[model samples]
Target: MNKLRIGIFLGITAFAIGFAACSKSDSSANKPDPTENGFDKTAMLTNYADNLIIPAYTNLQTQLGVFETAVNSFMATPTFANQQALKTVFKDTYLKFEHVSVNQFGPAEAALYTNFTNTFPTDSAAIEGNITRGTYNLTANSTIGQQGFPALDYVLFSPFHLNDFSGPNAANRKKYVQDLVARLKTLTGNVLTGWQNTYRASFIGNTRSDSGSPIAFLINQFAFEMDQLKGPRIGWPFGKQSAGTMFPNNSEGFNAGISVALATENLVSLKAMFNGNGSGKGMSDYLIALKKDKLSSDVMTQFDKAINALKAVPDPYATAMSVNKTQIEAAYREIQILLTLIKTDVASATGVRITYQDTDGD
Candidate 1:
């Protein structure tokens, strides 16, 4: 070959090799890390611990402090005005309880916090026996229904059934109320202390999505609480899940007639946790990162629908259950939809194995 032709061929070959090398380098640099492509489990856990869980428990603890004072005042006087003030504080504390109840792991699980704080459809007979005897153990599993918010609901609002707390049992009733509130205060303090002092670090640091990790426990508890909201809180009372038998008294806050209000607060808290409350990292963000946008949107939409439905039902949920059964049913349906999305789509996308037992066949 001529020198000029050889020089041109050599130049073209070198340029081609250099271009290929540059392209390969760019591709390597642009490739996403496998870990990054997977979920940032740490970010989600940190956001949850800081933004949702800690704040929720702290708020509950603060409210319970106020509630305890109110209880003490009411117990000292036991007048109608004092009773009204105590009821107001009790309702406030109960609403706050709704916000933190879904966090059923860490110290909460150890304390059986939910079972201790809000077991509903309280066994009136058991509660009465405890009050009459004045020697019952609050921590015993059999006393679950006789010592939580539900028991307070009975003593505070439905005292009329127990002879309006004006008969011989009045002092016993008051004592029982005091004991329940005091126990709640102590249990809540333990939970708050655990989170603030010890569990917070471990919760945020353990970022795996496996069964034993904080993330899995959170997801499972979240779903379990949603089921609680749908089934026992709404459906069972509406006769939709209890073989078409209306049992309005079975509702949460049934005596105080604020079941819908408490349910609304619970739903609000759940949505906040789902969205991470603008923390820039939540279950919704994690799902979206996993390309489960549809699932995330549907879950959020269902939450809004449920909240709106509950809002439509007037206050005094006991009366509303009879007069506004349709609205309550609608809210229950929306919650069920949300539960399905969380258990199936969100769980599948995130590889979170739900450890809670599902008996509702949903």
Candidate 2:
């Protein structure tokens, strides 16, 4: 071969080799390990811990503080004015609870934060029985229906239920309300401290996709939160789970007439968590990194569609549920479709195995 031809051929070979090496490095950087075309789990975890999780807990703690103050003020006089003020703050703080509800792992799981904080249509019967008897354990799991936001909903907004604070059973009723708020404060505060003090570092550092890793836990808990939104938050009260029995008051915050508001907030936070609280490092980013762009886009689109449908529902969801069942069911169907996308498509793309047991087979 001629000298010029040989020199050009060697240059081309070197250039090809260098380009191949660069491509491989780019793909490897996206992975959980040394494999090509993977994601940086640590970066995702760090984004979640720092941006999404901490901020959510801190905001919730701030709302909780305001809520506790409201409780104290109401206890001081138990006047109608105090009752109204307390109810306002109670609803705000309860809505804030949805922000941190999806993070039910590690400290939250240990705290049983969601179950303790928002279990609803709280058992008014159980709460009343506890107050009448002047005996109940606030911390016990079985007493969930007797405590939390729902119980407070009953205490503050149920039909003339708050009148007992000025009636013969005043002291007992007041004591029960005080204890319920205290339990919520303690459980929520502990989980926030857990995340802030040490769990943050632990979560960011352990960057595996295994069942116990941050990814697995986040995805699993995310699905669980969605299921809660679909089933307990809407379905049960809508009679989807009761053969169309239509228990409107069974909805969360129904006594306070804020069921739609709470459900909307819960879903808003879920979408934020799915998108990394707008930090640009959420599951959507992870999926996009894997070149699943269409899946990522579709999930987000569904989220928007669901949120819009939910917003279209009239307020006072409890009363509206009876006549507007069709509209509410339309919103519920949208939520269910979003749930399916996350469980099947998002879970499949991320490779995070969902460990939560599902009865509805989402």
Candidate 3:
């Protein structure tokens, strides 16, 4: 009878052990997956869509409307007051363009919107050809250099060509300005409407970092703009391109003498996008989510340094290029540091591949 009791007791102990093991297994199964525990991709995308991207496009559209009105007023009167007002409006619109230019995806990319609106260092010969012909196609790739804000700059501010707006060619020049502004207004309007009506939903829905994801596209565009800031806007004019030979004429806003101002605006827009301007989550928050606190801080600090350096550069950037080249180079170096941080550290931490090619070697 004692032996029988011992067998029963052993069986009970074995049952208890099995039951405990099964309980532990169930608890583990009920726990949340590590990948999904902290990250909320939907929230991030929603914030970007609702806060940063839409508002930027809206502001650009509004500014372009004002610009078009100013152009129309100037064309009607062609007086000094009207011309100055038009120039002021043009500057304002161009500054607004800087904010949205970094967003090179969706409708903007499909429309080649940047090329249509702000391609720089205007082709003087091509612009003259278009004006002389008066029958050229602004939509053609061939006219990209002749149809953007830079072309307007030529007609409005070129010292020798100031006559282009007030002399024998004035009629042709005015027509060209009117046409360019009209096209710019339409294109910008379309992009803004697209985001509001359709693309915003798709952009927010794409939360993955796959090839065509919004995050990937944003990163790619951000990188491309950084290269633009470093190379064409600053370096090319500073002579960092063209084998260390200074090309003051290549400066953006060369005719308007607002190159530094334009660069400052571009830098500010970049920083705003990076930080989301405190309105919502941005790339900085994404980096933090990836546990890249140091990288996030580093990138923000470098951007501040670059911006400060740019602010210190003298305005009338064409003049500064000749007399204060050192300051320009200083700003260029700071931007280069930022380029490395974003291209390497941020890209790696976020798993974003840098798809933009740096052709200038600066």
Candidate 4:
């Protein structure tokens, strides 16, 4: 063989060897061995301390600050001193803080104030009247006969039922804090689940085929999620008020009141759109047309088709953690098909068939 040919072959071999070495290095870089770093238990602890523990502690403190401000303001006013008014105020305030506590810390923290050791005085009408009548002259040391303002007890020593938190009392605080830490540890596992639920909702699905945009889908979904979260009615556990759902006087209620108000507004807006004077034609006319009229079998078929498509969308909570991205995409496509049909046909497309019977009519 020629010397030149032999040299070229040797050079090619060297180049191949160098390329192989580089590839191996890249592969090793890509797949670093987890065992090399061992278990990052300290890092995990640090994450909990920073992300979970610190945020939760800070949130509780902020809530307490708000609670303190509201309570102090209530005490300053005479009308708030009325027995009924005071009960409502306390109930409202307790519900507010209790909700955040429960949502963040779970039912156990929620139950911290379940049993009232000492109740805030609901029968302080005379005191409230006096305080209301003489507003600016109120003192922290002011006494109502031999007894002091029941509100003051809450302000100073944290009551058992009303103040279900880790306070200055080391023993009580330690117990609650331990329980909280335990709960937080459990919640750490479920963070991804909650994240998926919140995250997916941020991306909206296009319902309308003609003018459907991904951005629009996201915006609509975001709005819907927010609406559900801020439900006008009882979205979650807080709606059952009449069924002997009792809360202690010191329990936070202001936040609950705010939620209730928000829910109320949402409902009112929806109601106005569908049934109020804003829409001259009510549900009754639409329902009667849908039910009584001799509509084509195609209409029923379309309605059933749309209903099935909608029903196939997986339960919202099921995808709380991880869901197949393709599954979500398919669900959105089915919905968009139904939306297209609705947009195309006004009469046959709309499948709202409710009987709005008039009881007292002319």
What candidate 1 gets wrong by more than 4 Å, as runs, is: 1-39, 159-166
Residue 50 local lDDT, model 1: 80
| Model 3 misplacement above 4 A | 1-37, 79-82
Scanning candidate 2 in windows of ten residues, the lowest lDDT window is 1-10
> In model 1, what is the error at residue 295, expressed in angstroms?
1.8
The residue pairs in collision within model 2 are 30-38, 30-39, 31-38, 31-39
TM-score of each: 0.86, 0.87, 0.87, 0.22
**Candidate 1 overall lDDT versus native:** 0.74
Mind giving the per-residue lDDT tens digits that candidate 2 earns over 128-233?
Answer: 8898999988887677556788888888778877677889998998888888877887888899899989888777876556556667677766776677667767
Q: Candidate 2: list runs displaced more than 4 Å.
A: 1-38
Model 3 C-alpha lDDT versus the unseen true structure: 0.74
Per model, state how many residue pairs clash.
0, 4, 0, 17
What lDDT does the true structure give each of the candidates? 0.74, 0.75, 0.74, 0.28
Candidate 3: RMSD to truth: 18.9
The numbered model that scores best in lDDT is: 2
Better of 1 and 2 by TM-score: 2
The positional error of residue 64 in candidate 3, measured at the CA in angstroms, is: 1.4
The stretch of ten residues in a row with the least summed lDDT in candidate 1 is 1-10
The full ranking of all candidates by TM-score, starting with the best, is: 2, 3, 1, 4
